[model samples]
Each structure stands twice: as C-alpha cells, then as structure tokens.
Target: MASVQKISTCLWFDTEALEAAQFYTAIFKKASIGRITRYGKEGFEYHQKPEGSVMTVEFTLDGTPFLALNGGSIFKFSEAISFIIHCSDQDEVDYFWEKLTEEGDPAAQQCGWLKDKYGVSWQVIPVEMVDLLNDPDNEKSQKVMAAMLPMKKIDLATLKEVYVRG
Candidate 1:
C-alpha cells in the first residue's frame, strides 16, 4: 500500500535497510514494516548493488512513514539531522532514552539528544519542557534552560520545579 503522508523520512544505510527496519519496528509500539523492493540489473552501473539485494524498505514508526534505503557507506548520518520524539512525561522520556541510548555514542549525548548505534541522532524530549522553556517569564525560562543544559537526558520533574521556584 502507498503511504498517505505527503512527506516521509528516508534513512540511508550501508546494506542495513532491512535490518534497520526490523530494529526500529521492534522498538516502537505502533510500528510496522511494509513494502520492500530489491535492486535490478538496470542500475548496476551506478548503485553496483546486486540484482537481488534489498534496495529499500518502507516502514512506519508510531504513525510516521519512513524509508530505509540500502545506500552505500559513502554518506553517514550526522548530528546536523536528528529526529525529535515528543514525549508526554518523565516516564516516556526515560523509557525512550534508555532504549535508544543502548549501544549509542556516549560522547554525542547532550541536552536530551543521543546518537543511536547507527549514528542517527535523536532527541527524547518531554513536551512539558517545551512549554516551560518558552514560558513568558524570562527568569523561569532561564532557570529551565540552565537546568536542562547540563542533562544528557532531561529530568522533567526537576525542570518543572525549577520553573516554579524561579
């Protein structure tokens, strides 16, 4: 079936399209793998992928459509592009952080951002953080920012408390 979403994210992997799809589907509660296409001899000159090798795998993560392309290792994921997961509460933030941070790069983590094993970066954030950071009171906003800046994974409850006390 065709994806109804007008725009979708495409992840480039070095012969890990299928593997990545499976990995992601297992993590997300509302996830599924869809169409998987294989390469053909037509593009052998450019892609150089075997005719029967996986070309792309389409999958969905919590309702968001994605495509995992079996692109070569010529391009690697960078921190410049990252996905933000908007969580509802501290539990959600902690859960996602623990799961995604497994085998992720420790040096890449900062301000609730983490890099997965595949070098893909993600921000597991509590929605309340956004609201508190953007609060009308500059003092509260500054306090929230200060409390969040040092945390690799945000402590939402503490941030809220900081906002209130400020």
Candidate 2:
C-alpha cells in the first residue's frame, strides 16, 4: 500500500541538514532518512553551496515526514514552535529529556520544554498531564500546573504526588 502525507514539516538549517537528519533519526526508533537532493553549479551564484553538496534531505521521524533544507544562516529556530512528545511514564519522559537536552540550552529547560543541540525546542510531556489539566476540580489542576511551572524536567512522580495528596 502506498502512503501519502499531504502535510509535513520543513526545517531550515544553516548548513547541518544532513547532520540534523542523522541526529534525529538516531534518536527516534521509527525514524529513517530518505531522498537527498544536491545543489548544482547552476545555482552557485545564489545558494553558494558547493556543487553536489546536500541541498535537502527527506526524513521521517517517529512516523512523521520532515524535510531538512541547508538554507544557510538566514533563518534560525525559535521557541515559538516546538514538538511535543507525550511520554507514557516517567522513564519515557526521562529518556527524551536526557536525549533532547544534550548540549542544549540549559536555561531553556522549564515546564517540560527544552531546546535541543540543534536549537530545536521540544516538550517532553507526560501523558497524564492532559487529563490532569482537564480535571473537573480546578483546584487540583491549578496545583499541578503551579508545581510543573517551576520544574525544568517535569517529574511525573511529583505531579502524581500532588494529585493524590488532594
């Protein structure tokens, strides 16, 4: 069966399209690198990338297709957009938190969000957070939110503790 993805994400990198794709695919279990396009001498005046150098690399991460473009240093990633990974438990949360935060922006670690080494922001959220936030008891939800606000790597145990203490 042929699968089609009508919508996919495109990431712009200074010059690390291949490197970033490899990094992401290595971290995610179901990830893989696909087609790679190279630049030619025809566009040297504009792209400046060496002839035959990587221009774009198509990749799939955890089943989501993404395109990484070596678009030069014109555009940089910001915190406005982030990928969220809903972990089923603390172990899952910790695994992603440790992997994504490697040599990343330590200061950006807050409320389950962290910037990866490639300056890509990711949120390692516990699956229970959704239910906790949607809880009918506003007080419990508020407490959980408040506790999570000050955390760098969200502790599922702490959130669970707060909920049960109520």
Model 1 per-residue lDDT tens digits across residues 1-166: 9538888999999998898899888988999999999999997999999999999999999999999999898999999999999999998898899889988899999999999988899999999999999999998999999999999999998999999899
Candidate 2: regions farther than 4 A off: 1-3
Q: What is the lDDT of candidate 2?
A: 0.92
- Where model 1 places Cα greater than 4 Å from the true spot, the runs are 1-3
Q: In lDDT terms, which candidate is top? A: 1
TM-score of each: 0.94, 0.96
Worst 10 residues of 1 by lDDT: 1-10
Residue 166, candidate 2: alpha-carbon lDDT: 55
Q: What does candidate 1 score in Cα RMSD to the true structure? A: 1.4
lDDT of 2 by residue, 1-166 (tens): 8777999999999889999999899888889999999999997989889999899999998889999999999999999999999899989999889888989999999999999999999999999987887799999988898888999998988888898775
